[model samples]
Target: MLDAALKQQLQTYLERVVQPIEIVASLDDSAKAREMQELLQEIAPLTSKITLTERRDDNERKPSFAITRPGTDISVRFAGIPLGHEFTSLVLALLQVGGHPIKLDAPVIEQIRNLDGAFEFEVFMSLSCHNCPEVVQALNTMSIINPRIKITSIDGGVFKDEAEARQVLAVPMLFMNGEYFSQGRASVEEILAKLDTAGGARKAEELSTKEPFDVLIVGGGPAGAAAAIYAARKGIRTGVVSDRFGGQVLDTLAIENFVSMKETEGPRFAIALEEHVKHYEVDIMNTQRGAKLVPGKLIEVHTESGAVLKSKSVILATGARWREINVPGEKEYRNHGVAYCPHCDGPLFKGKRVAVVGGGNSGVEAAIDLAGIVKHVTLIEYAGELRADAILQKKLYSLPNVKVITSAQTTEVHGDGKIVNGLSYKDRSSGDTHKLELEGVFVQIGLVPNTEWLKGAVDLSRYGEIEVDVRGQTSVPGVFAAGDVTTVPFKQIVIAVGEGAKASLSAFDYLVRSSVEEKELAPTTAAA
Candidate 1:
C-alpha cells in the first residue's frame, strides 16, 4: 500500500508529464503479480495524464510493465516489481517517457548517439540493491536518446533461472548484447568505456613517463581520496588509480555515522567525494584496477589493463569486501533471497521472515535492525555464545520478533528455484540437523581484505590485512596503508579519513627526510 506522503511525492513528480503515458501491465495469478497490480493502481489515479491497462496473461513468466507514449512505437519494458531503491528508476522512466529530456554531459550524449550497431542491455537487479537504480537509469536515458540502444530491467528474484544461467552472483549485473558487461555499481563513464572497448572503437591515450609522482593512491575510497587531497595540498604531483571512484561506499545505503552530516545516502556521498577530489590537482585514473604492486626506489603499480604507473611513495587504501558463506544454493540465490548488506537490502524483505548468519556485532546489529522491518528474524551463531558486545546483545535480545540460536552451523541454503525459502543447519553440540523456513538470509560473518595483490610487495598480517603501525607506515619504507585494508582497529568511514590524513603526512615526512639526505650526501661545490 502507498503511504500518503509518498503518494503526494509521486503526484508532484508526475507534473512534468507533457502527454498521456500508458503503462501496459501483464499479470499472472501470483502474489507478487497482485502486489504489482495494486501498486500501479494506487499510483495511477494521482496523475491525470497517466493511464494503466492490465491484462491477464498466464504466459507471462513474471509481472511485466511496458511503457509507451502517444506517438512512440517502441515500448520500454520492465520485467519485475520495482520497489525500495528501484522505485526511483520507475519514476525516472515515466518522466523520460513523458517527454522530460534526460540531462547528461554533451560528450557522453554524443558517444551514445554515435554508438554503432544495435545494443540491447538486460540489467538483472534486485529491488533492494542500492546500486542498481543508477545502472538502470543510465541505460534508460541512453535508450531514450539513441534508438539503437534498448533497455530491459529484469528482477533477479522473479527470474532466478535466467540469473543463475548468466552466473549473476551480484546485483546490477549488466548484459550488453547478450554478453556480460559488468557487475555491482558502475558509473556511466565506466560503462561507456567498457562499451567502447567491447565495440573495438576505443581510442588509446598516451601516458606520460616523465618524473614519477610524489605519491600515488591506489584506491578511490574515502581513505585514498583523503590521502590524495592531503598530498595535493602540499603542491606535489599526486596520482590516483581506481577501478571505480567510490569503491565500496557506492554499495552502501545510508551513511549516518559520517561526521558533520546528519544523514546522507551512498550515491550522493560518493559524488561529493569525487567532486572534492576534483578540486585538487591530482591526476585521477578511473577504471584502472591494480593487478600487482612492485616496490622499489620508485613504486610501480601494474594495472589490470597492462599499464604501469610509477610513484615515489604509495598508499594502499583498497578496502575490505564481505566474506561469502560457502554453502549450497548460496551462489544461486545471491540477489534472490541471499544478501550481504542489511542497510541496503533490508527494506525489500519487509513483513517477510529472514535469517542472519553470525552472532558477532555485525550480525547482532543486523538482527536488531531487520526486526524493526521484517515480520521475524532468526539469528544463528556457530559459536556457543554471542560474540557481540554486551550492549548490542542486550538490544538484540530485547526485540520480541528476534530468535537467536547458538552453536548452529549452517550447511545448505534452500530455495524453490526462484527465491530462497529456507536453510538447513546442524547443531554443533548434538550433531543433529535442523531446518528453518525463511524468505531471506543475511550473511554478516566478517570481511576479507582486498590486499591479495600486495602479498609479496608488503608485509601482511596473519589475516591478510596490510600491516601498518600507529603512523600508518607499513613494514616497507615509503609505503603506507589505511582504511579497511590496514590493521586499524575500527573500520568506520571517519576513522579511515583520519588514518588517511596520518598516512599522507607520514609520506610527506619521508619525502622531506629523503631530500635532506640527498642534499647532505651531495659533493660540496667549491666556492668559485
Candidate 2:
C-alpha cells in the first residue's frame, strides 16, 4: 500500500533510528486487520532496523499496535490503523522509540518532565483528519520524555461505539485523564498548558495575568499573528490569546492560494505562521479562549482562564468556522457519518457514496476532491447554479463519478442510530422532496464568524461578523477586526494578512494622535 515516493520518504526518515524497534500488531480476524497487516508488512521491509510482529486476538475490539524498543519496557500503543495523516504519527512514534531526541525547547521539555502524576491521553481521530496527527505526535513525544504519560490514538471509524459514547463530534478530540481536554489541532505547548491547569499547577493562569499590553490580539490565526508582529515592531508591548493558533486553517488539507507558496498543508503552514510571530517580541498566550471584550480608553479582554488582559488597543481575529446545515440528525451524526471537512474525513468514506451540500467554491472543491477518494459524489446546491469559479466548475464537471444538482435545499440529515445512511432534500424548482442514499454527507455551505464574544462590544454585521472599515477599524475606537471574523470582502490568507497590517498601523496612528492630544491638554506652568 506504500507508494514509491512515500516509501522513499519513510525510509529516509527511519534512517535516524539508532536502535531496533518492534511493532507488535494485535489483530482480529477482520478485514481491517488484514489491511493493517498488509500495511505493516509493506512498511517492515523498507527498513532493516524496524520489525513487525502480528498476534491474533479475537477479543480485541479493534486492531492495535504496540511499539517498543530493546532494553525499554515502555510500550507506546496506537488503538487504530494509522493511515492517511496518522501515518506520520506511526513514523514519528517509531523514531522516538528508536531513541531519537525529542525536538522541543528546553523550557518545554522541563515542563513535560515536571508533570506530576500519571496522565492518560486518548485522542479520538479519523485517518483522513489532517490536523489529528500533530496532536497525536506531540502526545507521543511527551510520553517518550515523561514515562508517566500514556497516549493512545483511537481511530473514530473503527471504535465507533467508543466515539459515540463520548459524543465525539469532531476529529482530534483529546481526553486527558478521562476528561474532555480539547478538540482540533493543538500545539505541544498548548497541551502542556492544559495539563498544568488540570493538575492545578496554576502556572499558565498565573503567567497570563502578569502584565498589560499596548495591543492585545485575540485569535492567533493569520490575521491575529500578523497584527501582533506589526504591533510588536513598534517596540510596544503586544500580546495574543488563542485557543488554538491555526484556527480554521488547521482543518484545511492543502492551500494553494496563500500567495507565493505554490502549495502547503494546513499543519505545515500553521507552524510557519507561529514561527514568524515568535521571531518578534509578541507575547503569545496559546490555548486561551477569549471570553469577553470590554472596550474603553483601555480595552479589557477576558479569557476563559479568568485572566484579564488590559490593552490600549484590541484586534479581533477570531476566524470563522464551518457553518452547520442545522437539519435533523446533523448534530447527532456529526462524526458518525456527517462531516464538514472533506480533507479531514474523506478517507473514512472510501469506496462509499457521499453527498456534498452547498454549491459554493468550498462545496464544489470538496466534491472535486472527494470524487477521487469515494465511489460516487452528489453535489447539492441551493442556488440555481454553482457559485464556484469557472475553472473549478469545469474541473468538477470533468469528474465522471460526480453528479451535480442545483436549486436543491438540504431538508434533513437522515441516519441510522449510529451512523448516517442517507439524507433528504427539497428541489426548489419543482418543490419535490428527494432522498439520496449516501453513507456520508459533507456540508460546505459557508463559514460563520467567531464573533459571539464581541456582542454589544463592537459593531457586528447581521451574520455576526465584526463590521470594519477599509482600514480594518471597527466602529469603536481602539478596537479593530480582521480575517474572516471581520467585514472583509474576501476571506483569504493573503487578504487577512494585509488587513491585519492595516489594523495595526491604524491602531498605532490612533495612539500617536491620542498621546499628542493628552500632552497638549496638560496644565501649563507660568514662568516666574
Candidate 3:
C-alpha cells in the first residue's frame, strides 16, 4: 500500500492542469482499488479516474482505468503499469487525451487521409534491430491516424510460420492487403504512392523503374552493413535488407574498444556506421523484413512486399537475439527498466540503483560499467562463483558501488507504474528469500542465434550457432554466415564486421567459380 504522503505527491503530479492522464491498473485486490480511488480523489479538481471493474466484466484482462480531466478532449489508457517505452507511450496517450495532436505535417497527413479502403499490414521486427523502433512507431502512428490500416506487428522468431508463409527473410516487413508491399523505410509519401498503386481497381503488374541490385544482402548488424560497404566499394550492385537499419550494434551501451573508434554508444556508433555505408552506392532497405529466399543457379531474395531481388550472391548476416530468464514480469519489463543490452539501456538508469543478472563476462563487464554511471550496482549470480575471467572479476569487485552476490537467483520482478522498482530473489547459499529495491535490471544471460529458421538449409552448431569454416563458408557451398550467430569464438563488433566482410568475399568467389564451372561443362557438351 502507498503511504498518504506518496499519494499526495502523485496527486500533485497529476494536476499540472494542461492535459488529462489515466492509469489503468490491472490488479486483483479490492483494497488496492480503494487505494487508487483515494489517490485519484486527491489529484485536485481536474483529473477524472475510471476503474476497470466499472468498464469490463472479467478479471483475467486485469482491471484498467481510463483517465480523463476537465478541459481535455483526449482520453488516455494506462495499461498494466506503464514502464520503459511503455512509459513514453503513456505520456503520449495522456497528451492525446488532452487534445494534443501528435501533428504529422500536411504531406504526411494528406497521404494518410488518401489511403483507400481497409488494409491489413503485418510487420516483422527484432528488438535488437535499432531501426525496428522507428518502423514500429511510424506504423503505430499511421494506425492511430487512419482506422483503415490494421497493423499486425510480430516478433520475427516468435511468428516464424507467419514469416515463412510470407517468405519473410528479414525484419520490419510491410505487408499490404494480403500482398507484399515494399521493404525498408518507406517515407510517408512513398508508402502513400505505393498504396495508391496497389489499391487501384485495375490489376496490372507495373515493372519497377528502380535499377536492379548486383548483391542484395539480408540482415543488418555488423555483417550485413560491412558487406554493403565492401560490395558497393567494389562497384557491385549492392543493397541491404534489414528491419532495423543499425542491427545489433545499436543495443551496445558503450563500446570503448571497437577498433578505429576511441569510444561510442551503441546507437550513435551504428548511426555513424550506417551513414558511412550509405555514402557508397549501397541502397539500404532499413525497415523491410526478408520474407523468402528463392533458390536457383543465382540466389533471389523475395521480400514481404513482393520485391524480388535477383543477386549474383546473397550474404546472410541476421544476428542473434537475447535469451530470457522466463521469470515472471520478464516479458512485461523488457525495454523498460529490465533490459537485455547494457550498452543501449545503461545510461537511462544513471545515478539510480540497478541490478545486473548473470555472472559471465558480459554480466561482469556490464556491472562494472554500470557502477561508473549508476549510484550502485548489485550483481546477481545463479552459480556459486563468477564465470568471467579473473582480471574482470577483480575489476568488478574493486568498484566501490558494485556488490557481487553469488549463488543468487531472481524469482520475480516488482514494479508499479513508471519503471522497475525492485525484484525478489533466492539466496542459493542459505535458501533464504529476500526482496531488493532497484531502479533497473540488466540481463546478460546470453543470446540465441537467429538460425532456427535455417534448419536443414545451413549447417548449425550444437549450440545453434551457424557452423562456418575458417573462410566463413557454411556447409552449403554458396551460403555463408557471420557475426555472433556463426561459430565464431568472439562475439565482438569488430570480429562480426570482419567475418561479414570475409563472408561477402567468399560468396563472391563462389559465384565466380560456379559460373566458370557452368561455362566449362557447357563447352564439352556442345563440342561433342
Candidate 4:
C-alpha cells in the first residue's frame, strides 16, 4: 500500500512516538481488507512501540481499524483504506495516538476537555477531497483530548451503500450522535463555536478589549497576508482579523500559473502563507469576520460578535466566493446534490451522471475532471461556444463520457426533496427547454466578490466590487481595498499580493501626512 520512499518517511515520522500504540483491525475476506491487513502489518514493525491485532465482527464495518493507546479509552477508527488526500489524516491519527504533541491552542484543548457531553463524530469523506483532512484531524484531536469524543472516519467510496442510504452527496458530511452536524469545510474554531453557545459572547468580549491597531487588515487571503507582513515590517501595530485565514484560496485545487513555483496545491500554499505571516509581529485574529466598517479618526471595524475593533488604517482584502446560478432548487439541494467545487466533491459521484454548468475554463475543467470519475458528464454552456482555451476544449471533447451543450441556459434544479435527480435548461437559439437527468450539479459560473457588507460604507462598482485608486485606497481615507474584493482588473494571487503591499505602503504614507497635519493644526488652535 506504501512505496519504499514513503515507508522510509513513515519510519522517520514514527520515531517521534513517545508512547506505545495499538492497531486493532476488524476485517472480512475482501481485497481492501487484505490491503488494510498488509498496511497494518507493515506499519507495526517500523517501531517497537506499535502493535497490530485483528478480529472479525459482522456488525462492524469491514476493512476498518482502530488506533488506541494501551491504557486509555481513546478510539480513533478508520472504516476504509484512508489514502490519497486522507493519507496525512491517517499519519496524524497515528502520531496523535502514539503520544505525539498536537498542534492546537491550549485554550481550545481545555475547552474540549471541559465539554459536558459525549460526541460521536461519524465523518463521511472521500480520498480525493482536499478539504476532508482538516475536519478529520480536528475531530480526531478533539476525541484525543476528551475520551468522551469518539471519531470514525468513513470513506464514502468504500461505503457507498450507507452514504446513499443517508442521502449524503457531499464529502466531509459530519454527523454527531446520529444527527446531521454539518457539511463541507468546517474549522475547529467554527465547530467549537457551534457546540458552545457562549463561545461567541466570550470571544467578542475578548476582541473588544484589545487596543487599537496601526494597520488592521480584513480578510486573510493573499492580499491580507501580504499587507499584514508589509505593515508589521514598518514597526507598526499590525493585526489581521478574518473568519478564515486561507480565504477563497483554500477552495482552489491547482495552481500552475503562480510564478517561481511550477506547481502547488491551495491548502499547502495557504499554510505556507500563514506560517510566513506568523514569522512577523502581526497579531492574527482568526475565525472572526469584519461585519461593518465605521470610518472616523480611528476607523472602527465591527464584527459579527458585536466587537468593535478600532484601527488607524483598514485594508479590505475580503476575497470572492463561487458564483451561484440563482435558479430554483439550487439552494434547497445544496450539499444534498448541488456542489460548488468539483475537485472536492467529484469523487462522491463516481459512476454516476453529473452536469457541469458554465462555459469558461473552470466549467470546462470541471467537466473534464468529472469525466474521469463519473459515469458521464454533460457540460452546459449559456453562450454559443465554450470559452475555455483551445487545448482544454480539445481535451474535453476527446473524452468519451463527456457531452457539451452550447447556448443552453440553466433554469431550475430538480430534486426529489432529498437529492438532485435532474435539471431544466433552455436552448438559446431554438427557445426549447430540456432536462438532463443526473445525480449532481456542479455550479462553475464564476465568482462574486465578498463585499455585501461594504455597501453604502464605501464606493462600490456596479458589480459590488470595492472601488479603489491605484494606491489601493478606497473613497474613504485610510481605508484601502485589494484582491478580488476591489476594482482590480485581474484577480490573480500575484496581483493580490502586489496590491496588498501597495496598500500598506500607501497607508503608511497617509499616516505620516495625517500626523504632520495634526501637528500643524495644534499650533493654529493654540494661537486662536
Choose the strongest candidate by TM-score.
4
Ranking by lDDT: 4, 2, 1, 3
Global local distance difference test of model 2: 0.85
By summed lDDT, the worst window of 10 consecutive residues in model 2 runs over 199-208
Task: Give residue 98's error in model 3 in angstroms.
Answer: 28
Spell out the clash pairs found in candidate 2. none
lDDT of each: 0.84, 0.85, 0.65, 0.91
Any runs in candidate 2 off by more than 4 Å, and if so which? 1-64, 69-73, 79-84, 103-127, 154-170, 173-183, 189-204
Please, what is the TM-score per model?
A: 0.78, 0.85, 0.58, 0.98
Candidate 2 structure quality by residue, lDDT tens digits, 301-362: 88877777788888889999999999999998887788888877776677889999989899
Task: Let me know the TM-score candidate 2 reaches against the reference structure.
Answer: 0.85
* Candidate 1 Cα misplacement greater than 4 A, ranges: 1-114, 124-128, 154-170, 173-183, 198-211, 327-337, 343-353, 368-376, 389-395, 398-401, 412-424, 431-440, 523-528
Off by over 4 Å in 4: 524-528
| Deviation in Å, model 4, residue 434 alpha carbon | 0.8
Candidate 3's C-alpha runs over 4 A off are: 1-214, 302-308, 341-353, 368-376, 388-395, 398-401, 414-422, 426-439, 523-528
**Residue-wise C-alpha lDDT for candidate 1, range 311-337, written one tens digit per residue:** 999999988888888999999888778
As a whole number from 0 to 100, the lDDT of residue 159 in candidate 1 is 77
lDDT tens digits, residue span 273-391, model 4: 99999999998988888789999999999998788899999999999999999999999999989998898889889999999999899999999999999999999999999999999
Using lDDT as the yardstick, the better of models 2 and 4 is 4
